[model samples]
Target: MELRQLYYFVKVAKKEHVTQAAEELHVAQSAVSRQIHQLEEELGVKLFVQKGRNLQLTPVGQLFLKRAEAILADLERAVIEIQEFMDPEKGEVRLGFPHSLGISLIPQVVASFRKQHPNVKFRFKQGMFPSLIRDLVKGEIDLAFISPFPREHEQVCGEVLLTEELYAILPPGHELSNRHSIELIELKDETFVLFSEGYSLRPIVYEACQEAGFEPKIGFEGEETDTIRGLVAAGMGVSLLPEMALFYSGTLQPVKVRISAPSVTRTIGLIHRKNEKLPLVAKVFHSFLLRYFLDYNAKREQ
Candidate 1:
C-alpha cells in the first residue's frame, strides 16, 4: 500500500471515526474511506468493522497501526537529519592533512574555525601527502591540506595556500651551522636523512638536489619529520624541512640554515574532489581557510 493510504488508515484507526479522521487529514470522508479500503485490499486483510455510529479496529488493524506509526516517525527523523547535514552552522567537515602540517598548522586553523563556528564539528585524518590525496579522491575526506599542490587531475583541484622555504637541518656544531645560508650542491657529499617514500618532501628535495648536479648520499630514511630532525640533531645527517616545521620543533630543534643558490621551497594547499559539491559546513570552512591563509601571508610579508 502507498504511504498515503497507510497514513489515512492509521489516522482512521486512531480516531475510530472515518468522518472525524477525514476532517483532521483535510480530506473528504469518502476519499479517506477509499484509501483505507485500498490499504486493506493490498494487505489482504480487513482493518475495520462497523460498530453502530463509530468504527472499530480489527485485530490486524492494531498490528499494522504500530508498524505504520514507527515507519512514519522514522521518515520524519530522516528528513530532519538530512536538513541538519545541509546546515552550515551545525554540520560536520572531514578534514585531512599531512603529519607535518598536523603538528601545528592544522590544529591552529581548526581551533580558530571552531571559535567562530562553535556548532560545526570536525573529523581529522592524518597521513602523508599521497595518502591524504587518496582519501580526498575516495571521498573519505571533505578537504585536505597537502604539499606541492598535487599535479593537475580531472577529478581533483586545489589552490595554493602558502609557500614556505626549505631549510637545511644540521648538528649544533656542524661547520655549515655558522653560515647564513648554504647551497644544495654543498650538501651533495654529506649524508642525508630523508623522508620515506610517498612523502611529497622526498621527491621535492631529491629533484632539487638532482638539479644541483648530484644525488644526495642518503644515510637514513624516516616517516616522521621529527624523527628525521632528531637524526640531524644527533649529527646523523642533514635534511631539508619546511620553515613551519622548524618553528614548532621545541628543545630538540636542530640548527636550520637557509637553502640558497637555487633555493628550494614547497607549496601547501587545500585540495578536494573537483566535481563534488561540498556540504555547506565544508564549503564555509574551505572559504574560511582561504581567508586565514591570505591574512597569514599578509602578516608574514609585514
Candidate 2:
C-alpha cells in the first residue's frame, strides 16, 4: 500500500514469520498482519501462506519479493547519493561572469580552486553582468564573478573581491602611449571604442567621461571585451579597460591613467542571492578568489 507496507512485507518475507518480523521491527504481530492484508488488498493478490506458526511465500510473493528488494535497494542508494550531494565536498558548481572578468582574472582563480579541490567541477558561462546577475537571482547560476554597479538590486549580495583601476588602452606607437598617466580630459576629443550597451563596464567608463565634463565620443560599439581591446589596438579608438583585460589581450598594454575627478574604479567580486546558501564548491571558489586577489595585492605592493 505504501513504502512502510512494502518494508513490512519484505521483513516478514525475510523472517518467514509474522511474529518474528514484528519482534525484529518493533511492531505488534497484529499490526504486521494487518499491513500484509492491506498490501494484499491493494495489489489484489495474496502474498503469504501460514502453516503451523510458520509463514511461506506464494508464487506471486516470490516475484513481488524480488521487486520489493530492488525498490528498497534503489531507495537506499538514492538516499546515499542525495546525502553525498548534500555533503558539499563533492559536486558541480555552475558559475557565470562577464567577459572582462572571465578572461582576465577568473582563470587564475579557477586554477587555484582546482588545485585546492580537484574533485569539484566548475561550469563556467560568460555574459554581461546584468544578464548574469539575473540568472543568479533566478537560480540559473550558482556563483558569479562580475563588476557590480546596480548595487541596490533586491535578492542579490556582492562582496568586493578585487579593485581593478581602469586605464586607457591605446594603439602601439600612439601619442598617448608615451604618457605615464593620461587624464580623463585628455581623451575628450579621441574616439572611444567600448562594449555595447548592457555591459557592466560601460557605465563606469561613461560616468567617468561625464564627470570629466563631456559625453564619450563613441566610435565603435562591441559586446566582448577582447573585441574592444582588439579594436583599440588597431587605433579604431581607445577604451577604459580593467588591467585584467590587458593581460587577456596580450596585444595592447593598458596605459596608466589618472582620472582625479571621479577616480574611476571597478569592483570585481562574487555575487549570489541574498538569502540563498552557497554550495561548498562555490564557497571554496569564493575563498580562493579572495586569496588570489590578496596575493595579487601583496605582489603589487612589493
Best of the candidates, lDDT: 1
Where is model 1 more than 4 Å wrong at Cα?
A: 1-81
Among residues 3 or more apart in sequence or in different chains, the pairs in candidate 2 whose N, CA or C atoms overlap within 3 Å are: 196-222
Q: All models: lDDT?
A: 0.89, 0.81
Tell me the spans in candidate 2 whose CA falls farther than 4 Å from its real position: 1-81, 249-262
Q: What CA RMSD would you report for each candidate?
A: 4.8, 6.1
lDDT of 1: 0.89
Writing each residue's lDDT as its tens digit, candidate 2 over 153-225 gives 6788877776778887777777878777767888899999988888878888999999988999999999877
lDDT for position 271 in model 1? 90
Task: Please provide the root mean square deviation of candidate 1 (C-alpha atoms, Å).
Answer: 4.8
Cα TM-score per model:
0.76, 0.70
Alpha-carbon deviation at 221 in model 2, angstroms: 0.5
> How would you encode candidate 1's per-residue C-alpha lDDT over 1-112 as one tens digit per residue?
6889878988998899999999999999999989988888888999999999889988888898899999999999888767867999988899998888977888899999
